[model samples]
Target: ARRHALRDGVAIVPAAMPSQANVVSLRMPLALYGIAGIDEIHDSVIEAQAISKGDGIKGRAHHVVDSQGASRIGRYGWKADIATLKDMVANAFANELGIT
Candidate 1:
């Protein structure tokens, strides 16, 4: 994933990139476990509008093209690889907590 992001001119920063620092600071193992499915990309335009300003999650939505460049492809999975963390969490809660 890092290699592809580099090849396509995606600036691969450490997981500590400013917008992402807080999430990493959390000490919860449960939160860390699903991170890979959360903070994977950034979309400046849409990000500006999201409730979290697009900075709270850990993985990127798979089908949504990265805003940095055009030659790359998203490589994650869940909900056709485009599922949001909220969706993943909701599904997990339904199965695990029977919230529904």
Candidate 2:
């Protein structure tokens, strides 16, 4: 595949089947790792502001920011960093293949 890709400029490789749950972006400081189902997508939004406060081994069941930056709800991808689906696709493409 490598040789073919190098010579032919492209090669198709099958990917492993995916599971229902997948990783998406989180707003950072309170990262949401994996989402199981579409139904559970907005479940975090309502509580995106609550967290465990105080010092030492601090962990938030969820996270919140003081003045705000990104919002609690994101649709396109995890952390909802990219503003559009197109941006997400481009970023994923670049990161995966190291080709921007």
Candidate 3:
């Protein structure tokens, strides 16, 4: 029901439970859009925010944070939680699904 990084980290085979597939399965594609691939996630969030600032939506302007506590426009996740792909990936592995 979960995915683990293989020794090579090249291909994503599968998990014990395909139905309960790991968060990676759900996250990888989405994360790709967030990290490696494009700025679609950020663009969409920006465009939507520009059109309508939703205090209602689960994610709004989730600015990024640094060690100094400084932050910038968050371009990832529902709440725009993190600012960078590295952080996003880390967060994903840590707490995205709440399974761990």
Writing each residue's lDDT as its tens digit, candidate 3 over 1-65 gives 65656675768556566676554454345426325543435455564656544565544455567
In model 3, the runs with Cα more than 4 Å from the true position are 1-34, 37-60, 97-100
| lDDT (tens digit, per residue) of candidate 2 on 1-100 | 3355457767677787578758576543323345234324453643453344454434333332212354433334565444334444566679754787
Encode model 1's per-residue lDDT on 1-100: one tens digit a residue.
3356466877846654586455534343255465764445554433444335456754432344333334333333443433345545565568656898
Alpha-carbon RMSD of each model: 18.5, 14.5, 14.0
lDDT rank, highest first?
3, 1, 2
TM-score: which candidate is best? 3
Worst 10 residues of 1 by lDDT: 67-76
Error of 3 at 53 (Å): 14
> What order do candidates take by TM-score, descending?
3, 1, 2
